[model samples]
Target: MKVLVTGGAGFIASWCRRELTARGHSVLVMDHQDRRHQLADGEEFFLGDVRDATAVTEAAAHVDGIIHLAAVLGTQETISNPRPSAETNILGSLNVFEASTQYDLPVVYAGVGNHAFRLVGTGCYTITKSAAEDLARMYNLYREGGRVTIVRPVNAYGPGQSVAKPYGTSKVRKIAPAFACRALTGTDIEVYGDGAQISDCVYVEDVARAFVTALEHTAVHGPTERPVEVGPLESRTVNDIARLVAEYAAKVTGREPVGIVHLPMRPGEVPNAVVKSDTTTLQQIGMTVADFVPLEDGIARTVDYYNTEWLPGYLAA
Candidate 1:
């Protein structure tokens, strides 16, 4: 099968594209072409924005399946600029759905699991993603030839992830790479709020497999949308994550372990929460939470990547 992957240059999407290609499928990656990232060899590329209908349609023209992963992600993007985030995530998703319906292609909608609980901090991110996810289900239900599958993935982390990106005029990093970076550099790991927020962290490779599974599954078709969930087998608290990262960084780099630096919690984000896989939906999609990568091993690999790959390039630039 020839697959079109939007946001193919991103952390998780890059892994997904790799998995798809390894399974003997031809790939066409559509991305904004960030200078910080590079496309994989032996795949077609589309340098365009998902918000443009013409661009999406043109890219979809030759693919049998579509994996819509492009969006304005990150807490700062949604919190600071809700309007553009909504425009890109919601409106841009509509363009993908329209093109999918027109071409009669199957599409897999990558969604967020955090929205299953009450969103605490800047919710525009979840708001827009939820809207787009539901739209894909709508297309599956209402349209004659639309085939849409939904996969709501929990917090994912692994190698090949950037430490930070430009947010407004400043740079901010997510918890995984940020903690790894600070630990390797002998700096305190910043913990927001009370550091009690529990989350399910899955390895990127596992999440990539889930996306590919959903894309290839044929039983998902109907007006009612049931999202297949992907997550780590177990959940860990923010403090636990920090401690583990400190330990791993110490072992890997032979540096003294760093301490935690507590900070205020961001608004619109939840606390004391755990992202668990919906086993019932996983069964529906012929998957199990047991297939997820263990937290310790996943973190170790991610930290190694940050220490060996991400940090050097980040320091040079």
Candidate 2:
């Protein structure tokens, strides 16, 4: 299959691109950033923004299917600037759905696995993501030949995870790497609020597999067949993650364990929460919670990857 992957340069989308290429599918990666250096042999690249409908339409012309992963992720980024978040997550998604409808293509959309979307007090990130998902559903319902399979993934961490820059800083990374970097430097791992916020963190490889699996299967558009939620059975607290990252970073880099500092929770962020989807959906998709990579092992691999491959450049910079 010839698949078009938006946001192909991102942490999760990069893994999806790898999984797709490894499974003998040709990939057309569209990202504003040139990630051609990351492409496998026979994979193609397109330099454009998802907000540009014309660029998306042109790219849609050649692909058999679409894996829509482009978005302005992170609560801080979205909450700080709702305008760009809405523009990228909602309008950018509309372009993908519209183009897919026009080309009569099947789509696999990336969705969040948080139940916070159902609850009140959700932030702009959740709000925009929900709106985009509604557009996907509308496309499936109203447009002929429009098929979309949604995959809701949990918090993912692994090799190639980017280190987040400070808020309002130039570089932006994820939690796992942020903690890992702090751990390496013997700096305090900042924990917001009581630090009991729970999250289901899956390995990037596992999440990527779920995306490809959904793409391979025909759209199970039944009313109950919602976005297939994919993640490990186990959940971890933010405090636990901080401790583990510091512990592993010490072991990998021969550094001392870092301290943890509790800070007030950010506004509009969910607290003491964990999320997962129905097991029946996974069973129907030939998957099980047991298939997910164990948290300890996944964290170890992530720490090692950052230490060996990513940390040097970060330090140099």
Candidate 3:
């Protein structure tokens, strides 16, 4: 099938694009042509922004379905200052929905899950994503001919992740690498507040697969599906995650890190967002969480990626 994937160059979207191509589907990736999201040959990756409905419609014109993953991310974008974040996530989503309306295509709306639904710091991202996510479900209902599928993902991280996007995701982004970086460089890891907030992280690969599965389920169950979830089999605590990162970084990089630095937890932080889905609903549609990379492995893999990819390019001269 020909799929029009928005933001295909992003961390999770790239992983999904890889999987889609592997499965013999042609993907038209529509992104802002940022360096991070460039496309290779044999794929029709375009330099188009999701905020531009005309561009989205044209790009999605020949596609059988649409995967909308592009958005303004993070809590800082929310709590610190909000207009851009709100516009990108909420209004941007409306533009995509408009494109779907124009083309009469099935849309897999990749809405908020981690920060949007469960406990996440900051206010902007969660509020907008949640608002947009809610709107996604209401789209087709409002328009008789519209078809939309909503997928909410929680705590997704792995390769191709932006550790510097400066929102809540970035804040979360620093957590893993901060610990590993500290272990490797013998530096102090940055901690925002007390080290007791519980969170969950899904591998980028898992998130990519969930994007596909969400679309497939939308096809099988019809487009107006309410809420489809995809994430790890379970959740993890911050301390658990940090300890694993320190331990694994020590083993891999031969650097034993110090204990975590305790700070105050951010305001409005959900002490626990351990979302155990009634995945029974997902199972009915043949979508189940199969592969959940362990936190230690997630950390180890992150450390390796940072050493091999992140720090090498970004380390100051």
lDDT of each: 0.80, 0.80, 0.68
Question: Which one wins by lDDT: 1 or 3?
Answer: 1
Put down candidate 1 lDDT per residue, 126-244, tens digits, no spaces. Answer: 88898888788778778876787888888778887665633112244677887888888788998988888877678889889888878877424422247888877667788999999
Candidate 3 local lDDT, 1-317, one digit each (tens): 78888877777788888888887878888888754436765678677887777787788777888888887765543566788777777887888888777777777887665544433454677787777777776777787547787776666777656664321135444456556656555555555555555566667777777677767666556663446666666566677777777766667666666567776556545544443343444564466776556655676788788767765555552
- Deviation from native of the Cα of residue 204 in model 1, angstroms: 0.3
Candidate 2: clashing pairs of residues: 163-173, 164-173
Candidate order, TM-score descending: 2, 1, 3
What candidate 3 gets wrong by more than 4 Å, as runs, is 34-37, 114-122, 165-174, 267-278, 314-316
- Best-fitting candidate, scored by TM-score: 2
